[model samples]
Target chain A: MNLTLKVWRQKNSKSAGKLVDYQVSDISPDMSFLEMFDVLNEQLINKGEEPIVFDHDCREGICGMCSMFINGRPHGPKQGITTCQLHMRSFKDGDTIVVEPWRAAAFPVIKDLATDRSSFDRIIASGGFISVNTGNAQDANALPIPKRQADAAFEAAACIACGACVATCKNASAMLFVSAKISQLALLPQGQPERYRRVQSMVAQMDAEGFGNCTNTRACEAECPKGISLENIARMNRDYYAAKFASEEEV
Target chain B: MSSFGKAFSSSIGKKLVVGITGLFLILFLIVHCFINSLIFLNDGGETFNLGAEFMAGNWPIRAGEIVLFLGLIIHIVQTARLTYENRKARPVKYAAYNGSANSKWYSRSMGLLGTLLLIFLIVHLANFWVVSRFTGIPTHDVNNRENLFAVMVETFQNPWIVLLYVLSMVSLCYHLLHGFASAFQTMGWNHKKYAKLIISVGIWYSIIISVLFAAMPIAIYTGLIN
Candidate 1:
């Protein structure tokens, strides 16, 4: 299949960017979206032109390293999958695809389709961890956590930190990603010790990063490759407010 | 300011303020709609005048009016700030965005709906509220109550005014359609067992309240309630 690609190109975050169109022929349907880009980059090298730059590490979906807003979607038109998992078959033979970087002030465009997502790292560093020393994996029967609570925690933990939530949110809010991180710990027994402090600090970091607020549109959940729920946002709100009012600690 | 006061100024905290004030406005709509619906009694505006007079004269209701306006101001101010920051969050706009693919148009257009409602509210208050409270309506009911009902009848006589009310109510409906359950979600009151119920009730309430409010102007203009 042959396709037309309108890919964004920029020298760096400080420079202006524009869509530069390219044509590729003899593309296979089974080639992943990134693979198609690889083919395009190979062609650009043959012609001594700059190859299109984008982020991708694990060809598999779990790495959360691949970031592409393809055809007006975070990962692509398909739901619950990353760009690397998107195959060329999703489009028609002569389809024109628009590929852009994640558009958020917090995730500034680094080069081409790549962005600096270190803002997420700062939020995590603020307090998205369990400090307790569990010497070994507790015996399965020792902790006795309710099955329902454990399942909910697991669901919240599925967030890949791909910044799709921010990219899709009209406000560029990181609430879904932040709330998912908060909920993943807030629901578990091991996460209880610093639970209140965790929410307060992480939310502060999220706000400091210049991300916007959630308006409950649920666009994040809709475009999420991991199928993360918006319920985690509500849970985070609950805990954040509870910590503010109930805790006496300065944090 | 206390830490509590400081916390309330955060992004989530500001959203909490918007949600709480929005819910308060929702309650105000219920009261306003109910009193206006009394005009349907069609007793030469007697019952509607009495309800309007009670609302105007009762000290507690008068005091509540101040709180109502405070909620309105806070809601508007907080929303303005949020909208500004939200816009700034994406300094560079997307060349192509398919927002409809993920969220409802009304949900994304809350700011637009709200600005329309604010303009409508100012015009509406000028028509009835100012006339009743300060400017003084030309005629009173037989019981000598402030004749707000008469003002409503005179106001709706203009077809353009009627059209404006109808259009405003449509904006109100779309605003509440997103605001109702959205307020609950922002407050962290949403639950798996009741989230669906909240959304359903929100849809019905939005339709019913807006229809009732819109019906008044149309009913008066058509001589159905005069």
Candidate 2:
């Protein structure tokens, strides 16, 4: 299938960006979105032009490195799949796909469709962990976690830190991303020790990052490649609210 | 800014302010709708008149009115500021977009809906609240109540005023449709088990409250109710 692409191109963060249109033919329907992009880049390089740059580490979609808003969606038209996982079959011949970077205050453009999502790392650094020094490895069988809670925790843990939630949110909020991290640690026994501080610190850092607030529009959940539930956001709120109001002794 | 200031002054904090004030206004809507619905008794506005008198004269409600006013002021200010901030966050608008595909139109258009409500509130207060409170409404009975019921009967007689009131209720319907559940969601009251419940209940809550308030003017203007 042949397709036309209108992709955002920027020389650098300080440079102005604009949409540059190009065409590619003889594309296979089964080719992945990025692979098709590879074909396009091959064509661009053959013509002695700068190739489009985007982030993609694990082609399997688990690494969360792939971030592209294609045709007004986080990961193209397919649901529950990253850009690397989206196939060209989702489009038709002569289709024009518009590709752009995640538009958020916190996530700035590096060049082309790629953006710097290291702010997500900064939020996780703030306290998205259990700092309790378990002297030795504890037996997994020793701690009894409810099956339901474990499943939910695993679901929340599915978030790949892709920053799609931030990209799709009208306010550019990171509530879903922060909430997933908070819910992941807040749900387990090892995570229980520093649960209050985990929520307090993570939320504090999230605010410090200058990301917008969650308006509860659920676009993040809908566009999420992992299908992460909105429940995590609610859970984060519950934990943060409790942490904020808890007495010194209770905390 | 201090750490607390940073946290409280961020986008999240603004949303929390919107949620808290929004929930307070929702509560006020219920109370106001229920009391206003008393006119449906159709007993020449006796029940509605007495309810209005009590609300006007009672000290607790009189004091509560002050709190309600403050809540409205804060809610409007915070909502406006958040809209501006969120707009600033996305400096480059989407060249090709359909936000409604991802979320409801009402949910996305809260700023527009809220502005309409603000206009309606100004007109609404000018029509009744100012007369009842500051200028003193015309007397009706021997006991000399404010005759707010008579004021309503007189006001809805104007077709333009009734049309505006009806349009305002339409805006109110949408505002509540989004606001009621949004307030709780932002407050972190969402549960997997309860999230759907709150949203569905919010739909009905918005419909009932706005419809009840709307039926009053339509009923009065058409002489269906005195």
Candidate 3:
């Protein structure tokens, strides 16, 4: 297969970027989107040109290492998968793909197709942890978590922090991402001790990062590789307001 | 920040304000729509006139009008600020994209619909509310009511004015379609089983209320009840 690529090229966040077109031939249908990029980069290197830079680590969808907005949609046209998991087969032989980095005030561009996602990391670090040390791994059954609650927590935990939610959101909000993290812990018995502080801290950090608000458009969930539910957002809102009110009562 | 400070300061906090005020305005719409629907009694505007007279004369209802306008003003102001912030959040533009594919067009165009409604409100208030309340208007001969029903009939007589009212209701429909459930969601008012109910009700409420309001002007202009 052959395809044309219009990829965003930039020297750094300080510099302007533009779409620089390239064409590749003899692409295998089974090749992942990144692998196709690899073939393109190999051609660029052979011609003594700078290879396009993009972020990727696990190459599987789980690591959340890959970040690319392909043809407008985050992660790509095929729903519920990361850019690395996207196969060249999803496109026609002569298809033209437009690739760009996630555009958000919080996530600044590093270079071609890569943006600084440390803003997400900061939000997670704010309070996305359970500091309580459960001394030993008792029998998994010892925790006695209700099956439904445990399952809900697991579902919320599936968020990969890929920033696709922000990329897809009209407001560029990280509410889904933050809410998923909050809900993951907020649902569990183990997460109860610091629940109020956790939500308050994380939400404050999220706001301080310059992320926008959630209007509940659900685009993030639609574009999410993990299929994280918007229920997590509602949970976060419930918890955040609860925390705020509790703080007010204390005063 | 204090709790209220945080509510006013942060993105979600500000959204909470919009949601609260939006829900209040939604309630106001239901009440307003109900009163206007009374015109359909076809009682030669007698029933509608009594309802209007009661609404205008009651001190509690008059006080509610103040609260309703306060909520509406807050909603409009906060939403305008949020829209500005949202626009700035994406300083750079997408070179190629389809916004409608992700969400409904009405959901994305709240600002435009809101502005249209604002203009409609000003014109509406200037046309009837000012005359009925501040300025002396012709009173009903039989019961000495404010004759707001007569005011509405005469006001909607112009085809241009009727057209404007109809257009405003169209904007109202789209606005409420997105606003109803959105307000609850922002305020975290949801349940697993109940959210579906809430959203379905919101859609229907938007359609029904807008249709009812829209019908009033169109009905009055066409001599349907006269």
Candidate 4:
């Protein structure tokens, strides 16, 4: 399938960007979105033109490394799938596709469509973990976690840190991403020791990173490839409130 | 500021303030709607006048009015701050954003809707609140209470004011549609068992309350409630 692409291009982060149109012919319908980009890059190399730049790793969709706001969606017009998982067949022949990088103050553009997502790393470093000593592993049955709680935690853990929640949020809120990280540990026995501190610290870092607040629009949940629930956000809010108002620990 | 104050001043804390005040305003809407509906009794404003008198003269209700205004101020101020920061969060706008694909238009338009509602509130207060409290209503009912019912009838006579009321109620309807369920979520009150229930209740409540408020003016203008 042949298509017209209006992809945003920039020399570097300091420079301004604009949509540069490119025409690709003889594209296979079976090629993933990134694969189509590969074909385009091959053509650009043949012509000695600079190819478009984007982020992608683990093309299988789990890495959350692939970031593209294609045709107004985080993942190229599909639900619950990364851009790498999107196939060319989702579009018709001759369709004009618009590709742009994630827009958020916290996630600055590194180059063309690739962004610096290290802010997420900082938030995780702030908390987003269970403090376990480097020692012998305990018996699996030592901590009996309820199946329901385990399932919920697993669901929260499914977040890939793709930044789609922030990308798609009108407010550029990272609450969904932050909440998922908080909830993944908050629901488990191993996570209880630093549960309150984890939420407080992570949320503080999230705010310090200049991410916006959640307005309960639920766009994050809708655009999430992992289908992270807004319930995680509510859980985080509950934990944060408990930490501030109910926890015996002094600030 | 202390850590305690800082906590409440954070992003989530500011939202908590907005949500709490929004819920308080929602409660105020219920009380306001109920008292306004007394006009439907059509007993020549006797019952409505007494209700208005009680609302005006009662000590506790008078005190509650102060709290309500405080809630309103906090809600507006916090929302303004959130909106400003939210806008700044995305310094560059998307070249192609199909927001409707993932979220409701009204949900994304909360700032616009809230602004319209604020304008409506100012006009509404100028028409009724200021007259009733400070300037005083000129007419009186048989019970010697300020004839607020007569004031309502005269206010609705102006077609422009009626149109403004209807349009404002429309804004209020959309505002509450998102605000109601959003308040619950922000307060960490959402549960799977009741999440859907909360959304449905929000829809009905938004429609019912806005319709009731809007209908009062139309009813008065048409002489249905006189």
lDDT of 2: 0.86
lDDT scores in order:
0.92, 0.86, 0.88, 0.93
Taking the tens digit of each residue's C-alpha lDDT, what string does model 4 give over B158-219? Answer: 99999999999999999999999999999998889999999999999999999999999998
TM-score of candidate 4 versus the correct structure, residues matched by position: 0.98
True contacts kept of 2: 0.52
Interface RMSD of 3: 1.5
- Summarize candidate 2's per-residue lDDT along B91-207 as a digit string, tens digits: 776666556667788888888999999999999999989999898887675456557888899999999999999999999999999889988888888887788899899999999
- Model 2 misplaced stretches (Cα beyond 4 Å): A132-136, A249-251, B1-7, B139-144
User: Compared with the real two-chain complex, what DockQ does model 3 have?
Assistant: 0.65
Instruction: Judging by DockQ, tell me the better candidate of 3 and 4.
Output: 4
What is the TM-score of model 4 when looking only at chain B? 0.97
Q: Candidate 1 chain A: worst 10 consecutive residues by lDDT?
A: A132-141
Q: Write the per-residue lDDT of candidate 2 for residues A169-212, one digit (tens) a residue.
A: 88888999999999888898879878888877787777667677
On residues B1-226, what C-alpha lDDT tens digit does candidate 3 reach at each position? 5577875687778899999899888888888889889999987777888888888889999999999889989988998899888888888877877566677888878889999999999999999789978886776835766677788888988999999999999999999999998888888877788898999999999999999999998888889976
* Residues A1-251 of candidate 1: C-alpha lDDT, one tens digit per residue: 99999999999999999999999999999999999999999999999999888989988999898999888889999999999999999999999999899999999999999999999999999999989665887677877789899999999998989999999999999999999999999998889989989999999899999999889988999999999998888888998888888787557
Docking class of 2: medium
